[model samples]
Target: MAASQKPDNVAAVMKVFAILEGLAAQPSIGLSELSQRSLTSKSTAYRFLQTMKELGYVSQEEESEKYALTFKLFELGGAALEHVELIPLANVEMRKLSEQTHEAIHLGALDEDSQHIVYLHKYDSQFNLCMNSRVGRRSPVYSTSMGKTLLAWMDDNRAQEILAKTHFIARTRYTLTSAQQVLDELPGIRQEGVAEDREEAELGVRCLSVPVFDRFGQAIAALSLSFPVVRYEEQKRDEYMALLFDAGKRISSGLGFYDYPFSRS
Candidate 1:
């Protein structure tokens, strides 16, 4: 609080971020150049750089001694993006789908190990009865429409790898119990551009899902509409599928996947 004393904490934070911004603007730089870019003394920049390096956000090349940002920042960005970017983008489409059908809509993504689907967001149906689910709840990938849609879009090798680790305990009589059985269904799901859970994960609950692709054409998530069997109208299946696919395409487009693979069948 003394006049002669600087606000050490605030100054240090500013300097650290200044250095990070400088490093980000350039591919790589030595301590002297980095100090100039960040507008700090070489010693101060070096101190901050060393700390950041230890924290894995900055790295110095072995041969050049030039410091640069690392994949850690990219990894952190991706992690932040999943919740920050994806949910908001998907929520817009989910709300539209919910309005159209007045049915439960869900946005689900693969968990860290890729063995399960975790609900990231949902819109409850207008009806008194709907699927009991919440954000962050995890479900087996083999028994849910969202899970099947995600798997159907994955390459066989990767799909097989995930299936190899999956425990195919039958959630219900309709649940596919073997990897081969699910594998056999993938082609049809892919061809139809949608997947169905015919009371697979839970009795009397039927769901349909379509893939939400990312810029790289990877199925980053799945969008689904769920209804109790009593509320489901078999004749309106195609209509519901169209609504889900429309939302999926819109959401995928917002994610930078302009060429969504799914087409009406």
Candidate 2:
């Protein structure tokens, strides 16, 4: 970034960036309102808006008198999404896993921009294991087993940052609201290569997930299976865990992990 002539500081950059983010967060933003909400002088705000307009980042609305973002961001992001190769590479494998276990299977990657679990595909279970969940939907990273599987594998500093921003809302009674407990389980989850949610997101819904790595040895996403909690009582719990681990291993191997580093078969 060019050093600004005007005695640059974090506060100044934050204010300016907040305005841009505010506009991006919503569909449109107006001139006077953007200045007030961003807590910046009208002249300074207008100058930045004009700069954004020239850079093809923001556009003016004729009737609403609002500014909206352009396609510049997506043009940058879409390229990376295409390169992941999980959509085509993992689709058939996900279907096979779902069929094998008679439970729903999902493929998700941590969306860096949103810090949420972005579902790539959701293979329907034989008898509908939680029909409520949708493909392309995002769940909080700290709330889902599929999310925690990846989060637990991350380094401490990165995990702390994630937990700091994470809201940890108890979607159901079983949800982990305390980061301390979740952090405590990181080591075991990392060692075992599997994570579980016993009715955490919703009542009677249990899920088990294991991490899927990329060629770069990064935990890119997780392969998960979900079933009703009642069905997983006692002896059945081990079976469910095994099924998720086996499928996760297959998916990870297909993604270029010749040998899954954790939880041997």
Candidate 3:
């Protein structure tokens, strides 16, 4: 490709994706709405839509004269996801977090049957006094940061159902010892897009976690950073949250979720 033609090619590619995103955002839309949403002229948008329709990636409702995406994207996405192994994909992001924070990093998933967070992968902290945990260790959902994160992003009824079964054992003085207490805190966790274990799961250990989503936008896993209270700096809470959220977003994206439901800023 010639350097002089690159800008036009890039702009054309952007326009196509923008139109595709616009269509994906709603059930269907007329050309005018799509053109405005995509920041392209009607003629350009229509031309792109026609090309996509011919390619079987888009469909046009004859009665409404509206454009919408076909299941082609879903088919493509499903094929891609089929080849992706979750733990290895997560390890790339987890390793980066482990290096950056030098803390115990964990990847956990909800074990719904047991109502616990199962550690899928972990990186032990470089410090000798780090959190002692291993892959496959199960921790109560009511007391751990990763567990709370998984619950926070879940549907309220489903979350409540899981909470109802929880024994709510007080692992420490900080633990929330009731289902209602955990339920009350879930909204705040969702709003903040993070969860905290303030020595609740274990005395003298503090952990922060963020949810990791899949293509269906379900919170399938959580990424967490753990530190002993002696090593955890209160002032660096924001920095720690940022790192965890970043890793969560990256891992979620790898799982085919483009929209990470959290404010980066």
Q: Give each model a TM-score.
A: 0.75, 0.67, 0.68
Off by over 4 Å in 2: 1-84, 128-131
Q: Considering lDDT, which of the candidate structures 2 and 3 is the better prediction for this target?
A: 3
| Global local distance difference test of model 2 | 0.77
| Per-residue alpha-carbon lDDT of candidate 1 for residues 131-194, written as tens digits (9 for 90 to 100) | 8999899999999999998999998999999999888898888889999988899999998898
Query: For candidate 2, lDDT tens digit of each residue in 95-205?
Result: 777777777888887886535888888887678445467878898877788888888877888888888877768888878897787788788888777888778877888
**Model 3 spans with C-alpha error above 4 angstroms:** 1-84, 112-114
Native-vs-model 3 lDDT? 0.87
Error of 1 at 264 (Å): 4.8
Residue 54 of model 3 has an lDDT of 95
lDDT of each: 0.90, 0.77, 0.87
198 Cα displacement, candidate 2 (Å): 1.3
lDDT of 3 by residue, 90-124 (tens): 89998999899888999888773748988989899
Best by lDDT: 1
